[model samples]
Target: MIRVLVVDDDYHVAHAHALSVGRMEGFVVVGEAHTAVEAERLVAEASPDLLLLDMYLPDVTGLDLVRRLAAAGRVVPDFLLVTAARDIDSVRAAMQLGAFYYLVKPFSVAALREQLESYRMWAERLQGTPERGRHVDQDVVDSLYSLRGAPVRRTTVVRTLQPTMARVLEIVTAAPEPISAAEVAEVLGASRPTAQRYLATLVKKRLLDLELTYGSTGRPEHRYLPRRS
Candidate 1:
């Protein structure tokens, strides 16, 4: 399994993210940290394979932490920034620092899963190659960067979701207001979990928007709406 370290200032949010990571196949949350210092220590101790990092930390910025790790000669794991930072400078810095992916805050489970799966594919390909300095062609290099801007082909996992995704998008778009997964399930004659999976997939594709709705009884629930172009 791919071990993951989740870092965020908020304990609740970090724990929630850890839970989500644990739910994903072939991945497990090995540790959680609320500060850059703690995260750095955990990276060294746990030796996680990946990190889900939040940009704004109590001690240092996530980008600065990346730089610090490099400066310290620590073997840095591949990381995806899970941040609320929306500034262009932040995004540019993350790219320059070699973040595997950037995921804005309040993302769905499917969004994180998509990036994880993409990274898994890239990691598998790299591992399959001989480490004795084999020649890598342009196509192999292009595949390594497939998460950025590659044309979708039938063989890719994302392409396989297109057919059912169309139906999910149709249902979400036709709704007058943000709808819950249970409601969608009832409409589509599917189980709640099945409907939730489809809705999360649509959110990951940017075809739907996910929001939180609070009721008097339980934790806030996710509601989905058609994303405005």
Candidate 2:
């Protein structure tokens, strides 16, 4: 099992993250701490395979904690930074200081699972595997670099989709309902015509399933639900 240490100043946040880590099979939560000083002691005592670090701590900044560990000739476990702060400068500094992955707050369980599973696979590859798959090789190398360097700045990747399509996808995925384009537009802050165009795109992408409702109204309205896996 891959041993993990969780460090967060907030007790609830630390416990929640530890619970999430424990839920994944083949992973163990070995320790948790609320302050940078406590985190340093835990890291030394636990010697965890992965450290789920928080950026803010009561005693010191996470970056300074890492620096102090290095200066003290202590062990530095592979790190995954889970932080609420999203400033580019701080993120850049964390990357340079050796964080394997920088996860922003409000991430879903799916996202957390995705990152942890990726790290696990990479760890497996590093343990003297004879031949690594292409995806494994790429993911492992990229993850390492992400830990060591700043992430490239770019506009939101999710916004590349057509506005209506994006809104439709978010809503349907969150709550599946056969919502008309007008309704979707109102909820998503888009024009009715624009919503209609994106709705068609979402249907084309197979992200939404459209159904026509024939009520005694001016026209038959189309509703959409999320396409489940």
Candidate 3:
């Protein structure tokens, strides 16, 4: 089974994530922690395979907890960041840490399950490799890198990114905070409509995430964020 440790400052939200993981197939909630101190204790006791980590914690940030663990030469599990923080720096840091996935907050159970399924497949592949010399071949390495839980029907992978698509991705990934199409247009010297088209495409490609902020008067504004690799 894929053991999971759910960590969030909010008790209710942490319990909700743990319950959701418990209901899934072949996954178990080893423990839930509302603070980094509790999380470190549970990591030693439970030894979970994955962490549904929140960026904001009462003691220290989730990212810092991971860093501290590594610095102390402690065992660290695969991380799946589940947080509301959309800053580019956070995303870059998570990627550098080699997180399996980064899930944005206010997400649905179905969305979470989709990523879990992909993770399960990837983990199974790693666990199932032949033991002769205990080394994976180039094909296995390629498969590991290419598995992003993308749709099974997506086969025509683009080797080179289109100029506009590349620019939109760059702008969002470098942004200090979640930005809107208007901001993107201003940065690219393009029209709002044109910016929206590119942002929508990036979201569809899973290269960026779209968040909605609702207002009392009008429609919810769509904000774009960089998607973690």
Best by TM-score: 1
- Give the per-residue Cα lDDT of candidate 2 at 65: 84
Per-residue CA lDDT of model 3 for 1-229, tens digit only, reads 9999999999999998898899876799999999999999999999999998999999999999999889879999988889999999999999899787788888898778777767776787677678768777899788877665432222222223478878888898899999999999999999999999999987866668899998897799999997755
Model 2 compared with the native: what TM-score?
0.58
Question: Would you estimate the TM-scores of all the predictions?
Answer: 0.66, 0.58, 0.64
lDDT of each: 0.83, 0.76, 0.84
State the local distance difference test value for candidate 3: 0.84
lDDT tens per residue, model 1, 128-212: 6667668888887776677442333324754435566667767887989999999898888889999999898778656679999
Where's the lowest-lDDT run of ten residues in candidate 1? 147-156
**Residue 104 lDDT in candidate 2:** 91
Evaluated at residue 34, the lDDT of candidate 1 is 94
TM-score of model 3 (CA atoms): 0.64
Candidate 2 lDDT, 134-186, residue by residue in tens: 34566656644442323321222233455555656787667645788788888
Please report how far candidate 2 places residue 98 from its true position, in Å. 2.0
RMSD, every candidate, angstroms: 9.1, 11.8, 14.2
